[model samples]
Target: MHDQNFTSLPDLHGVPVFYPHGTQLIWISSNGEITRPSRETLAAEFALGVVLLCHRRWSAARAAIDIDHYLDVMELFAFVRPARFVLPTPSGLAQQLGLARPQQGEDMAALLPQIAFILLDELASTPDPARTEAGRIATMMTAGGWKWGPYILAHLGLPQPLAGPPDSRYAAIWDRLADYTDYTPQAEPGTQPILPDAARQRLAEMLGENAELRLPQADYAAAVAASFDRPDAGPNPAMVLAEAGTGTGKTLGYLAPATLWAEKNGETVWISTYTRTLQHQIANELTRLYPEAEAHESKVVIRKGRENYLCLLNLEEALAQMPGRPRQAAALGLMVRWAGATRDGDLTGASFPAWLMDLFGRSQTNGPCRPARRMYSCSLPAL
Candidate 1:
């Protein structure tokens, strides 16, 4: 299959074909004619057991392609689906795997050999642990025999059957972090006082070799450091209104002192962002302070509203309706896989692809359950 050259639509009748742009499905006929099939014809062909392959399933579905039969190569490999901004086309996958991308305007049919080789290579190279997990999830969703199961088994080899239904007990683990009783408050001032030079030095250290000491950034850090001075404030609170133009390193400037103060005082410092994008940016910037992945997970946290995370109850409800909803079941199955591997329960800005919600017709992260709401009501201390 990897060495075969495809010249016509009949050659790819039952074979997986790569289509990068998802807005429309194109076919190259035997006479070298490009044709776009109607959604009805596409559905009929799928109903008659025609198999199509694509990078992202959601894109094909949007183009009226049947979601039940088509194989999503990206989801098959990634396990955790990638964001939409990252294209999962043959070229995109090749680039990610450090292989050469298909040339521009290259024949789509001729690219079949390369695509087959890429998929086979990726499957062969996948770690056993990941393949096992992916197979288990796929088996659970397909129930050992469904439309996509045979294809997966024939092409990629069958994975182990699921041990049983996934344990829902693991779902509430996020709620356990809200135990404020375990938190101990800091009563006295920290032993090490935060000064402008010290904060600037910390910032420099955090930036490493990329550190470009800006005078304004140091001054900003100095101003923010003064906020910790109880003696200076006396009976009132100290407020610093800083105004800086774009491109000034204000985030690192303030973070230096804030992190230092938190560490020395053994306190939690809450840094709020107006937008989710900025929140993610701040989280990314913390990598400089905590370079190790596990240490960063333990140190810095991104807390959002209850609506941003998944509700286990809602997921159970969605799963219960899986009878006539193959698409919904597939989406939920993917989410279940993601839940197991997610760093936090956050479904919005994390690795959980936004397109999955679109597949199921609604966002899973909205409308928290009562228990989830109550859990979010309590104060969560930083780890």
Candidate 2:
């Protein structure tokens, strides 16, 4: 039955049959005849077509077929309930893969089959064979002996299932933050101070050879460097407030001396910004000093209010109510995928797509569920 290379789609269509208890499988013929086939028959016919399509499209490095026009053939095959978890919708899958949204007036539903197959490919191709969400689902499918499982296992070679819940280093990070202690002031070590000229020179070096030196920016840098000379016995701390218009290099000006002071004194420096956008800009600027992603992550931290991040407990609670709430569930499932992939877990500023946030609405992203909270906060070692 699977031997025929399907150049064009047959009349067969599979539609998800959702019940109060769970989802069921039903087939629709081209003549508009609706029928419920036995599991064995479903496997031999409908399931075989879906598998063949998957093989025909994704078996190689790239798909041989467009698979866009065959959404109806792959529709019923997309719905899978493995033990407890509900897979995200195709739109959520697209978001997780960092794919761009469909254009205005385009039908996103038409691309579901393609999105679903891409997601399956990702699940089957996870590196190092870890106990990821992919592995967990694969294990569940193998254990349950789902009709379509073998085709996926044989063609894509799903990662071997490891025992226990999926590994969540992301969740563990937030848990460790619960024991966060108050910052204790430390004595600044006596080191040769960096004067204004030296600070200006450092700024120039950071800006690179092509950068034009601005007189005002250099003056600002020198003033900031001079502030580091405050005596330990001073009753009040030295503060400098310089008013400058946009594009005057205020960020690099201040950062030049601040970084020098911190490096010389072996101290932590905190640079506060009024907006998240500026915070991200400052973080990007820090990259010139620390080019490597891992190095940058180690040296710079972006701090924000607790409400700005995703709470793991809240996500768990949301996932539990996925039975009827398909939209929210899809968003939550995408968040679950994102949780594993995000670097800092900043829901607003991190890699999580802004459009995906609009999917489930703001409630889920607002860091609700106050009872037991664990939030992803960005942090760096030195500054």
Candidate 3:
């Protein structure tokens, strides 16, 4: 996580940049001269990230920041310094640079920063007014009392915008910026019948071009049909246990009938699965079965576990307690990026490291985190 997100990274005790994971820097002069530091060390990398995103304040404190997206800083930093480099890897620098992972013992960490220096030096602009920001930013680094003050003060300078408009998001900072929703829970179970045969026929028709009904799937569909046909349509719903193995097309087997039944009866069926991933998978299939018009009306919706979301309240508390906690720092970096990008707040398909899970588990709750009080309250209503 790298793109300039953490002016929030606690300005620790007059030390402008103190990163946990390894980070290194390459100092470039206004005249485009390059100075190589010890690329083997983490000391320069984190500081480099700080200087890259440092907002000039004619004073020590940075300009007031507006955090609009979930870890915009992480994206920024990643763009400059991919975490895959600093973090230990068997492939090392070669892999991080998209080169073939070599078997030789060349120190990748040592080499990467130097290579990075070469690239930046080549790209560095001529010493001129456009680079005034870079010079001012390099000055800010020296003003922070870094051990490498003389080097940064001499070499680095230029406040060029790292990204164009495509990479930036304004901090409109919506609190309850959720979908406009108005729904009422049904008071009783819907016992009315939807034509199972009609739904079954529809499924067959839709898949007719490429798919044919398998014997096991057809049998499963027939059993579903029998359950609905039961004479004893009482308040106590009938239970149907099914057994099918892989390649059985069981999803379609049950979906064909269930779609018909729900359509016929105008009822919502709660489909449960062992994992949230599977839950979304089923929801996607339901969408394919139904048209967009009906799908939006609760015909298919994913009801995830409480943990699968970004909690702003928890995030604030965590940031407050972030000093001296490196794992939380790393996890927060990932969370910040996730917050900005994910649409439904679903953690599905996201890669969560152990630290992130530890952090998320601390904030997760079965119900609303708290009774609705403020915008950042525990409850995040799904739309």
Query: For residues 314-359, what per-residue lDDT tens digits would candidate 1 score against the true structure?
Result: 6766665555454444566666666555555566764666545544
Q: Model 3: what TM-score?
A: 0.48
Q: What C-alpha lDDT do the candidate models reach, one value each? A: 0.57, 0.50, 0.41
Indicate which candidate wins on TM-score.
Answer: 1
- Please, what is the TM-score per model? 0.70, 0.58, 0.48
**Model 1's TM-score against the true structure:** 0.70
Q: Candidate 3, residues 1-383: lDDT per residue as tens digits?
A: 11333233322122222111223333332233333444333333333344321111111122222211111112222322322222223244345445565443233222333433332442244355423433332332223222222222233432222322211111112332553223455565456543546546756754566887676776666566645543467666666788788987777777777767666666666667787667666766666666585555345656665455445555545544544342344334335444434444444433322223432454521123333333222333331
Q: Candidate 3 — which residues are off by over 4 angstroms?
A: 1-74, 77-172, 179-190, 226-232, 290-299, 319-337, 348-368, 373-383
lDDT string, candidate 2, 25-122, tens digits: 33444333445555555444433343222221221113212322223212222322111122234344445456665432122333444555564565
Q: For model 1, what is the alpha-carbon lDDT of residue 210?
A: 71
